[model samples]
Target: MYGSQPARTGRTTLLAVLLAPALALAGALVLLAAPAHAANAPRTSVNPVIFVHGQEGSAQQWQSQAKRFSSNGYRDDQLYVHEYDTSVATDDHAIAGLEALVDTVRARTGAAQVDILAHSRGTRVAHAYLAVPERAAEVAKYVNLDGRTAAAPPGGVPTLAIWSSLQPNGSIGGAVNVHEPQAGHTESATSAESFGHIYAFLRGRAPLTTRVLPELPTSVEIAGRALYFPQNTGLAGRLEVWRLDPATGARAGLLPQHVVRVGADGAFGPLAVNGRGHYELALVRSGERTNHFYFEPFERSDRFVRLLVSPPGGVADSIDACPGHTALTVVRAREWRADTEGDDRLRIGGSDVLNAAVSPRLRQILGLFVFDKGCDAVSHLDAALPPFDRIPFLTATDLHLPADAQARGTIPVTQTMRGTGGIEETIAVPNWPSDRHTVSLLFKDYADIPSGG
Candidate 1:
């Protein structure tokens, strides 16, 4: 219905049609009144974004994503498409591309650094800049988009390595990339809703800590190993946290109580990240009634001990929890809910289909991606169920994540294993490029409350 009008026709309708492009572009940027050609601010200008495509791809690999960002607000000048021989080791021309591109972007924009978003082997090319040493300062942020390289060339420059799910080999942290989804990854950028996390993570924001609901201390842990309360069980203790809504300013969401086991051996957490990106308890106390909530981040043994004596609120505040606290890991949207013949399906990016007006049953806001596949690729005829041909999501089995996902994506995928706490391991991964990867985890104390209500 919205067709372009011929110019100089002098028709009022023609003028309206011609003005559309200018208006649409203006809307993409937050400001409507800002002049279209106004020069961006110096030093604070948005650094150029160099996109490194994935395997089985081309610059066309980013065609859908590129158009999406442009429609949202990103200008063409800010996007640089770096193509390489996917067959080669990726160092030869890729390194040369990075060196030349960084200098060009910095010189042209007068910005101190440039940002990079690379997929799969593309990430390898982007990181190689660190080896040059001179160009390292020219690059501000490097988003290893699903590329699983954990080796960090010693540099103080902060890096946010994005991954799809928890993969053992993918971590630059001193320890293995933490598997706790409730606590976001400290070393790698892991989240289920990759798109929604792009903005803040690109800006260098750490995981946002949640306010455990207002409640009195009902239970206490005697030592780092045991719980003393309504029931003295073999299990150590459990955690109960209320979810705070940043928008409504209320406890709109909540996570089930997570328990930790105390064996004669030692302390560990078998927590996991679920498809929705929430922390799932893998183990619960052998036997117990309801109890208050307390959570201590997995920092050092001292923090675990401090949690035992630590006054509820401020006690665990500064401690670095396993996986960083972020909604990106927890945000989810229900897709293909009405499917009759196929299995349930969901979109794994930060795009939360659950919270949309389409479904009231969806009560959570998890993620938002700047560039999303609106499914323009899938024919409107093929996506729809039958008479109503609306674009639909893929089946459960088809939801795969981008590369490097398992290495980083699982921090928010914790709700799967219900238990106390220990170390949840990835058992089996059935999906890829997924909101939640098919994996197993080992938690100490945890439980599963009926969700999707």
Candidate 2:
């Protein structure tokens, strides 16, 4: 039921052709550096990698690293993401789902073993899966990212534990521990530095390029799933893909580029798109508000684009909806740190939202929800709102951005560099009334950090 989708089988052969020159150069270097034993040993292939996400996390968290791997030489078919419901009390269901995914990956790739990478709460689940000798035998390597610590590597597998600045002293007894002082909790998993460490640990050599190299616009294609938040259940709806004007984030045309009826699996697309183009993915359901997701750009073919939504009249429905204001949620894989020196900056409608109360380092906020708190039509930029601030990995702000659904206006959202620099990115999106439309924006965690060249 899981592996039958076209996305699971679609291979990015075009990427290989484009990267041949770089790959060939890197291949020669490996041969020259090989030891006598390695030259005599059987030729080995890169193992299929399966990524497991943490609590309230989806496969989207691994989006950037997956692209980096592909750029370095991994095929589209060789990467998999195990998405599970993180709200459950125990790891029983997560372990089962991961085991099934691992088996499926092995069956399709025809490999004896696969590599596992888990972050945050997912480390516990991965460790539990590795506890069984049979399961451990199926894994070639393991990466524990800013998650659990142990006296020894789980199941005695070769492990790499990556700790962020937040956990300065975190480590595992029998694993290679690398500390990234510039990153926060989630950033340690998505940062280019983290990718370098992971690639070296898994491949026994540094990556040819840690960056997510871009493909030509004509060669870029995308596909993904629309799932219920926290449950990982697919949503059946009408999905519309519309190209947007990068400057103002306005629709390019009246008609969508592609219209699909998303099935129970919530899978859609293998649709071609411009690598430099911005897009809006609108998920529309009958008698329900449309959830509109905006992305910066698809620099390459992406298969893990997740559109997470809650059921109508569900958890999200509890949000205060009003016609007088626009509601927006900005997401980045990196944790926002507003309480620290030289902290990150987030500006919406020309006002900075990051503050000591709104984005404390300990909160490790990945999603920042902005709206008029209590429909009071007042802007309180100094502090975070209740309920949302209490939630893990999330925070909310009360900001008044007037909107008219009939005639939309652009609302500029700017993110300045964490340290000293001018603006890093500015994504201007339309101000849609919160009563009928929901806006979500995706931002890269390492927007200013370049990978190893």
Q: Choose the strongest candidate by TM-score.
A: 2
Q: Write the per-residue lDDT of candidate 2 for residues 258-306, one digit (tens) a residue.
A: 9999999898877888888899899998887789998878876788888
The C-alpha lDDT values of all candidates are 0.33, 0.82
Q: State each model's C-alpha RMSD to the native.
A: 25.9, 5.5
TM-score per candidate:
0.35, 0.90
Candidate 2 residues lying further than 4 Å off, grouped into runs, are 1-9, 13-44, 312-315, 448-451
TM-score attained by model 1? 0.35
Give the least accurate 10-residue stretch of model 1, judged by summed lDDT.
Answer: 1-10
List, residue by residue over 1-453, the lDDT tens digit for candidate 1.
000111111101000113356657765212111112113422335666666655422343343333233323344455555654444543677678667766766665566877776666666776666656677777776666556565563233455555543343455543122232322221122122343355455544421211111111211111122222111112344433333222221233444434344452223332221212212222233343222222222111110211111122421122222211111111122111222223222233322222223211121111211111232222111221211122121111111233243233222122222122323222111122222221222221112222110
- Which 10 successive residues of model 2 have the least lDDT summed? 30-39
